[model samples]
Target chain A: MEKGSRRSFLVFSINWATALIGGVLSLAAGIPLIGFAISPAFKKGESKWVDLGLADRLKNSRFKKVDYTFTAKDGWVKATKKRSVYVTDAGNGQWSVFSRTCSHLGCLVRWDDQKESFLCPCHGAVFDQNGIVVAGPPPRPLQKLQTKVEAGILYVKDF
Target chain B: MGFLNERLPLTEFSAHLRKPLPKHINLLFSLGSLAMFLLLLQAATGAFLALYYSPSPEHAHNAVTYISEEVPFGSFVRGLHHWGASAMVVIVFVHLLRVVIYSSYKAPRELTWIVGVLLLLVVLGFGFTGYLLPWDEKAYWATVVGVEIASTAPILGVFVAKVLRGGSEIGAVTLARFYAVHTIWLPWLAFGLVGVHLFFVRYYGSSGTPQNTPEEMKTGKPFYPDQVFEDVVGMLILFIVLAAVALFIPVPLEDVADPTNANYDPRPEWYFLFLFQLLKYFQGPLEIVGTFVIPTVGIVLLLFLPFLDKSERAVLWKRPVALTVTTVCVAGIVGLTLLGASSPKLETADATIVQEVPQPTEDIQKTATLDTETAEVEKEEEVFDFQLTEEEIEGTEEEEEVFDFQLTEEELQ
Candidate 1:
């Protein structure tokens, strides 16, 4: 048979067409399967403002770590989660609220009164009073939360 | 027997069993068979453990505790699995080292070497996901850190982290997701890869020892008696070691996962300690260098080893670059692991969030006055609008409801 015979062309066309159809058909199921598996990644955490009691309670120089419980919906379960944040009231209506979450590996950070900085115990990471990285392996500063004072009570946005 | 042999490939299988082994084949060559034995043993033990294991945050720890304390021979089985993981890692690495020492990954066996490297990774994946099944403090925190590490990758980092975590946080869903992947996805992958790897190994035959000449390599004995005996003995020794450790030094189940417990100091498994220690070196903005860039370069180099050292030199010392690089990498890994192991464990045990000491009466009064003045002024100035509007709050809920996948009250009814 000639290399580019009409019958050979038909056979070539059929083979490629079958491959394309087969590929599209597999993708039809494969895409949904993949989407189903990765769907949880896009599930957002709960976003709400949690009240951290009276603003008067917050100290100026030292951070007052406030631990609160709030309901968070994740995947198929709704569970109450306990989380903390350090709040410093800087006198003239200036308030700083830093999420206790460590930037290096998400371990909780503790405020060390002696060092005047936050210390992450997991990797010995140290952050200054302003939540800036000072020592150890912290990649970023402590996460800061949005805080608002409406009626002497301090409210920090939680996610 | 004749009918079955004719229908199946029983005759061919016997022929393979009787295949010749190169004269230079020694105890090191049997490690591959030992690795395979361990993989199967782990699967058997893990299946038994999974019978009683519950993959949920609420039940995971309790299930493990029950297995340890209540179930008959459960702790022993679980211990085999626990230590077997470490053993598998060790055996796989040693087998790989043997291969490298002989430079057995040379041309014609390149694909075999590639698949072997992938199998090594699969074994590691088994270790990573399997450890988390216990859902103890160590496993939970390590996974949190691991997923966080994944999130450090540029661009797709967050997405990868989210996929691994299965949501905003690791929870029941995360446990279930990990369980499914550990038990199902990884096993099937390893099985398929192992089959392919063995096919390549059989097809190419043993690359023989690096020291063997072409004529010496050709001189051989049937695999049945000599090589089979050696392989069997190696597997038996491995089982004895696994059993001895499992029986004598039983694995402990730590406290159940407490995400809120800041007092717990999280540590990675010994195999991962090297990476953990390396991460400490690259602090702050350079973390990406440690977590992603260097490890990635190392893995890429490893995957392309056959191509990189394409000299067809099976002998180790002849390949100076490969020898030096492998030696340095081994030494580095060992040094980092030792450093990490000896590093203080209780550095953060007392590092709980500082309780806001009720300021002295004088300070409290001063703070009260300062707070009232700010509150009075702040009430007039715009409140930072931190609270989401009611509509926005419901809108988020509505969006979440779309992905809920759970039946609503009406639907349930």
Candidate 2:
């Protein structure tokens, strides 16, 4: 081949090689970031059992407020956080723990002794003592936290 | 003469000394290259995005959220893809207008102009399809408007809408179809059209000084070194601008899909808003004429332009008719866009105001009377008499009344 053609070919080859390397590296770096951006749905699965404290502390005939902490890990990063909620007995000696997160919207629900129900401040969604939907645009019952007695201590799912 | 007569290789193409390009390549000229660069950027980022995007309606919103939040710098990548698309459309339109003003569409270059117009339509199709993939409220109804417009076409409207939507309604099928069109089909067409357009530009070469230039007037620089440098510098500046936009203001997410709600104000992206608002002005019979007929006529006119204006003159100043028409068209577009931006407050035809009618005075009086009568009846019933007969008292005193209650009742009778 002539020198000019060979030189042009070399330049084209180098340009293509650089582009290919850059593309591959970008893909390798970008996929994970894309994955991270969509991690909220996946994070749903990582929610685990959180110990809220001793079952004895729960007041009978009323909801007792408890605060607890648990660890969450996203890939290499791990975080420990505290969250509070109310715990009540469902009248059959069975404990019913509900998430403060409102079902209608995500506002925190507080126990209203006067109304004898859980009331959401953002909207007027009311839940009965057993966490059954009583009124308002809630559309569903409050989300029940998965709980168990571990050595007489109440542990509930944090998410 | 000896130096000029020296052997030149056949492989080396010689610059046409008879024609030259203008030296004053302004910012307007840079738009085409910027658009092309943006197209490439969009394609790259879009391809990356497609790898992680889930096309199911159930998962599409979640997947987009995941990509934005969980993926490292995924937000930035998606932002680049988004803003790059907007930039492409804007830059292409500006470049087309620049060509129009210079009368670059005259004679042999008409095919280039036609292809450029098609590129604009394809870019719009890209926007339409890409908007639907997120499966959010804004994406959903914007697509609904798009499908409705497509369905307005005579004879082939339903078919085209179905083909684009992938079914009777928007769902998993629609999402997949839009994803395919946005990521695969439209991009392929655009890439091919762009290649042909660029090839023609290179073959015909740049349209130099306007038609009225003196014969002795110096034309312009060659394409290789000087124009190439300008293009590179423009691309670098465009890259910096795009980078800054992507990094600082990531694309905003809207409320997630809730199909039952009808309150969403479905507007197309800002670039297409003018066309959307244009549809509004053409009402009733005129709508069909304006939306479909007029635009179709314009496109047909644009395509057959080379044959229509066969004059060899390329001078803008000499072509008063063409220049006037071009200026009028541009001014009309600018006016329509401003009107569109301002006229969003105009009520949509489908929006209805629900007014509660007050109850009549007679009905209210009748209800009050009924309540009062019911209360009086309750009060009357509360006051009951309690008296015992003599026979009942005697029966209570006798133990025999328990055993012979029938006999006692017969005696009383």
Candidate 3:
């Protein structure tokens, strides 16, 4: 037998029609499945402000580790979650708050007083006291959080 | 043999095994069979690991730790799965390189080559998904960065990341999703594609050696002892090397995942380090270029190579264009991997100058950016001077460029 044999018109049309029917049926079910799977992307993370403590007291502290819990929505589950941040007093009325999370990869950075720098054990990424990249492969400085001091209370926004 | 021949197709199989192979075929031709051997090894070990493995953010780390520390030869099996993964990637790539060098992917073997490339991708998919199963800090964070990188793709990035993550965050669902894909979906895909690949291989029959003529191949030895023996030997060597690696360098499991730990590092597995490092060169909106465009184009071009390479030339040096393309790509991947591997490992002299616990933000940048100030500061005490990146300099340098700094900073350097 030779290669590249041509098929009859009936067979050609039937094959094409069969594929069309299959595609239509598959798409009819596949679209909804895809939509259901991707539904989470459409939903935004719930954000709220978790109060830390008094703003004045938080100011001028070398590096105060502040852990706080807040009610938040994670996927379909809504519950209370605990989070932490480093609060350092920026000379003046300004209080600088930095999220201990490394900006590169989400690794918790520990404040090493011996090194006097925020050290990321995961990648050896060093962040200076002010949350600036002193060394290693952090793409950006330690993530600085949005801070608001109301009256005598200190608060950092958490998601 | 006589008893089995009566009950099974043993005689026919033995007859099939005696198929003729080109005499010119050598060790390089055995890489395909070696790759398949590694796949089988992976499948067997992965099944065993899955029996004890738990896929959840809460228990996955514990499960892996238990397997590594408690179970007899568990660490060995886990290590095989881990190192075997990298070995598989390496062997598969080398096999492809061999195919390219010889014109084996040409003509009737085009479908086989295409399917082979797809199989390589499935292997890579396994690597990506498997990295998340341990659910340790490293696994969790690396997957976070990986998913984030996925989210950087244009149009469908969000959907892609969410689907990969199985939800809004990399938590229990993400682990389960990765586990299912790694243990189930990928194996099925690999097995199916491998079947197609093997079928095509048999259908096309060896493209024969690039140097030999079909007439010469007619006078070659049968596949029974010559080729199969070589294939088995290659596999034996691979297994020995793999065992040595697993015994000496067991895979590490870092601290358990903590959602609230802001200081967690998100370094991707080594196989993905090249892509992770590639993203460093791209910033902001340009991330899509590195994340999606380049990879998509690379895959498409790789898929179409057999069609494009009309040069039926088989010898490595005969095709100048193919040689150059392969050289550049191999160099790029190697260079990028080296760069990615070395990322986040930089250590410098400690600043014993007063505890900068609350160091002035400018002081940190000034010491790193200014050579003169660093010299002056070093006069008093040892201080680590860090060169600022262009992005960092732009953010803080304009106010301090009076130090007469170069526009270029050691970003990657």
Candidate 4:
């Protein structure tokens, strides 16, 4: 390279090196910091399967409202909360346990015996006997909780 | 590499970087860049804060407390993000004012001006949404009032309020919704708007000072070292000031939200204080005028400013109407904000500061003499009561004297 070209090349190299080194160092520090920060969002809440009385007690071809209480541990504080769920017998020994929380918003839905349907007091969203949306503004069906039966007892995961 | 360079217009990019900026571009011109820097800082700190933040109403307050008291350097990071938001709002507004004063929004930059307004709106949105994340009393009430104001928009009032709050009232759903908007939606919108603004800036080039002469362009310097150096210096000073505030006076978190507290007085952030003050003049029927009409008219006028002020002259003195309007509007906002801050809300229970009535001259002189006499007695007692050895004496001298002086001062007062 000519003398002028060489001088220009040296200046360009210094600038490039400074930017490259700074970018690399920042990436090295920032990536893990961000990862560590957002890791909790991906982590599930510290809740476990809570047993909600007997599965056999749920009447066949009908909805039985059950209320379960569970203690939730959030950070350093432990809170005992009571929640209601609607359990239905789908015949053939099958069952559907639905969380009372409406799909549109988390407001509790009540099963109206007169209407034979679930009604949300918040936005008037209605769901049918099978946890499916019948009418109103609900985008989808009611949320179903993960359920398991052990020795005639029904267990559902609570978060 | 050569093919890639050719395809990417590398030569043009270098030319843009090496383009000479007007020599008169000073620190005020760097406000836009400083705002951009503060935005980045806020994004980083907000992401970190979001890591430990729980959006549910039950855990939100606890989670914020955990971040402040448990996580490593959490309070410092939260403080930086909080302070960075206020800084961004001020800087962006100043940047807008600078553009208006210099007539930089005129021709070839009208779209840039519009995009800047959109960006300001997004920044305010970020502030409104992020204020609720801490789930405190002030944040909750301020949001309730904000949603109420939105609900006063004539036909769509009820619908607008419901959409904003995610329900009939602010609750868990509102927290989750605001969190998603604050962390995800608003940031992406701001990023796109900033990109368009920066592109327009690069394309049209920097708007020089109002006093720039044609001959001055030839004597300007490239942006790389000259302008970049000033930006670096300005950013450094800003960072130092921000860090000092974060370290010395960290952001405060009030008590957890209590929706049943009827006596709580809610106030909007300082930037919106002008509008908050305006709402005071109107009663029931005229509230729509205060909440919607005036703000909408102000925004429409700001959006069309570049078109309305179409003068070719960039000098401030030559444009009397534009200058006068801008000055009056800015001064009105400042005066209103000051008034709003100093005045107490209607429902505020203990807003008054009771002043201590002064005594007569004879009584004041008697108190002063008594205070001096007590101080002299304490001093004598300290000198005579020192019976310890020199080594023990030296160790407690500072502590004893300071404690005695404070004790005597309090008793005298």
Candidate 5:
């Protein structure tokens, strides 16, 4: 078998063919699997410009707590979620909305009027009016939500 | 020419590279090399991932998201890394099994066997630590359970758990520590052990097979072309399979680590499911038996196997006791892992943990005090429910509705 030309050729083809087939088949199954796996990573945390009522009601340079409900599309099912934000008038018709959820551990944060800071009771994390961490173990400032105003109506994104 | 030749052993090295092995070498023999290839693949893909991965809790999940979504071929590389690690685990186990069945860990190869065991432990450590780097709910909770299990070790339980976690809880410190161990520590350990294992293999040469007689071993074929060709073919097949798996069944990255989400069920990676299953049988004080004693005994037995099986005959039939014991252990692992995988998670006694805090609710009211500079705070204690019911825990209904098997909701979004 070693000396025979046709036999050696057959052996060579078989060996290489096995490898080629394996490579081809793996790709056939793998490409779609990989595509399916990575699809979620590409999904941007989408939010809609949900109306938060009259923009005129929000006082200039003052923070107001706003609560709004929107249907959140979570994968296949959509659920009506009640979300809150702190909307502060930016002096010139613009409003900065901050998510009420604390940046530290997802616990809800409350504006402590006496303390003059947003306080998280879970770990005593404190944030200033601008949403920056004032004290404690909160890594960063509270997440600010995208806000928009149109025709005196205030709106905030669910992102 | 003489000086150059003397400085480098190129001629001798070339001669050594082409050294022959017994012609009886088969595809099964190539499993170890295939495992080696997968390890290299993991290292390469891991390096690519590390370029974007941030170990801190704040950016770890975001970094992973960026890698998979933003960087070109980042998802592809990540998919390869995820699936490749799983494949490596399987191949490493199979390779170990093959070594056992072949009785190749006998006599002069005792050191090789011991080193191989250490390598397996390192591979397992890599899986455990890497599992946490994703910083997802599953990763977070699973590490919590894993660390808790470690803390159950008799005298050194708390110490070991503290060392593994870097603190009392799974947080930023834990994530950074795990990242360091997985990327820097385990790879170095594997490389060092692999170098020594290869040295032993070369120094002793191929053990060939028990089937091959002394005379047959003398007339073996060269390692470079014949055996190397078989290895190449095997690796190609493995690559194709790995690629298909990566492409078709990419691993899911669940929601970022949220300790508050009680709905999430914590399960270990598939390899540890057997031991995870074992823990179910012995609860409370006897938990140590499951976590420490049984596993310790099993590993001790495996380490001392070469000495225990004193028979010179390497044939499977000749070693009845060894064969039965190995078969039983393998069967136990498979059975337990499958059982654990299929079993619905048992309910914990306290699913809901409530924390009281003053929070802004559906309504807010502000009052002016005497000073008026700082508004009078309304202290309202609200109960934040973190408990999940059995109904919520069984979330498979919605996940099944989206895609049968192609992608889970978590993977989809």
Candidate 6:
């Protein structure tokens, strides 16, 4: 009985070894095929919500201009930067955050109170209160940042 | 001896099938097979993409960027998949033309031809769904056109649009619905239909010339060693070409999507550019007819082509009428695409132009600087006086007042 058990163990070991080797080889061969299949799912860079600043500075008006700085780490390198924005209300206490990034062609936008809009000085692209293109060569309205208020501090996610 | 040889065993059968196939299977014959190969490649790459892609608008674009930049070999894989899809569309159309020119849709192969037509529609459907997955402006507006097209479908237009969008407009539901159709539903249908079509082709064995002429007819070699070898070589060549394109010229990404922006010149993907341009020439009733009616009619005509052209001859040169029709169609598509690419720019209204505010003269700037310093000193004094008191932050009221001013008139001029 002991001799029989030893033989069975040897057979099992050989089978297991063969299966393991086969599985590894199959995976190696299949990698390219699998990569071809799933390549469409891969995306290069993602837009992340970069924090802008505190909410206390943005109260009591339909629009508020606030500037804030944050550090971004790509791989091992870290850099600090500041961005300014105009946050307006879409009614009901909710805010629509506009990137001063001009819709005309990436120029900085300034608030022209007389025009009641964000004015792109570069090509004269004008956006109304809702950020619709009111005038100029700008193909689109201003980019809006996703925002949230935390503990009286305004935080915006910049793309 | 002849009967004994004909009733050969498995080994003999294998040996008999190992002969060289015909050499005359032209470049046109290759498009369908190439399309099929690319479809498989798309499915594989798309699956990998789906693993990491988030359908939610909040994360969709970011996820795409992440896969491109962060994932291992992600960019190459995504690029291959994207370019592969575009290539498949081109090849499928070419394949259809090849069939038409050769009059391969006659009697015995009618069903095969019909299946091929459906496959073309599936390819377009794939292009449409895949275009919107990136959630870019181009994708968004192209989808707007798609939704608009669906809404023009008479009694069921509204229902179709709602079902496709998952709601009234493009949103999370629309994204999810598109994702499902793109990655799941359409793929299964395409695979099954393609499989049946291919199986029938093999069974019928190349429907060669039904009306064989002694001079025009050529006996083909077997399909194994000859045709299979050529197919393998073709696949390798296609791979090399695709790799070169993907590496040398990466797909372009448009600016992020913002629905509030109306000035964006939203164009569909290049594959649909012809259709997009077609809509421009159409006005009111003509728009509906050109955009929806004409395309539908074309598709139906293609489906019933076998009956329309009941020629027995399979030699492409013998089918002059069909060949001419196919050539015209190809030329028309190519011309329309070129026109679409060079579409005339839409005129912008003058009222929307924002005027820049001129800076005051240097002397005025110095005066404003003095005024700002005085105001700062006064503000400091007020803060010092109110330090012990629980008075709210000063100037908040003034800031509120300034914000209330409508800056429209000054901006417009």
The candidates, ranked best first by lDDT, are 1, 3, 4, 5, 6, 2
Q: Relative to the unseen true structure, what is the C-alpha lDDT of residue B83 in candidate 6, on a scale of 0 to 100?
A: 92
lDDT of 4 by residue, A1-159 (tens): 566797889988999999999999999999997664344334344435555544554536255566554444333334344556767777766777777666643445666666777765433456887778776555568888777654454556654
- Taken in order, the candidates have interface RMSDs of 7.5, 25.1, 13.7, 25.4, 15.9, 15.7
> Which candidate leads in lDDT?
1
Candidate number that wins on DockQ, 3 or 6: 3
- Per residue, candidate 3 scores C-alpha lDDT tens digits across B86-171 of 99999999999999888788887889999999999999999889888988777777777777667767788778887888766676
**Residue range B198-220, candidate 5, lDDT tens digits:** 88988877777778776776468
Report lDDT per candidate.
0.80, 0.65, 0.75, 0.72, 0.71, 0.66
TM-score, each model? 0.86, 0.56, 0.75, 0.61, 0.63, 0.60
**In model 6, what is the error at residue B202, expressed in angstroms?**
0.9
Candidate 6: Cα lDDT at B173 = 62
lDDT of 6 by residue, B1-413 (tens): 66876676756656655643333456566676788889988999999998899987667888888877799877878888889988898888878767766676776788999999999999999999998888887777678668767767778776667667654546666777789889999999999999999887775556443344443234566666766667778878888888888777766667666653434556678888787666655543454675579798889988998888876656666767876877787788888889888875433411322211121223433332345433342232222211111122244565677788677886868
lDDT of 1 by residue, B232-260 (tens): 88888888988999889979778988776
Once model 3 is optimally superposed onto the true structure by TM-score, how far is the C-alpha of residue A128 displaced, in angstroms? Answer: 10
Best of the candidates, TM-score: 1
Error of 2 at B339 (Å): 2.6
Which docking category, incorrect, acceptable, medium or high, applies to candidate 6? incorrect
Off by over 4 Å in 2: A1-159, B1-27, B211-219, B310-318, B344-413
Q: Candidate 4 chain A: minimum summed lDDT over ten consecutive residues — where?
A: A71-80
- TM-score for chain B considered on its own, for each of the candidates: 0.84, 0.75, 0.81, 0.81, 0.84, 0.78
How many pairs of residues collide in each model?
0, 18, 14, 0, 14, 42
Looking at model 1, the pairs that clash are none
Global lDDT of model 6: 0.66
After the best TM-score superposition of candidate 5, give how far the Cα of residue B11 lies from its true spot, in angstroms: 1.6
DockQ of 3: 0.12
Worst 10-residue lDDT window for candidate 5 chain B reads B374-383
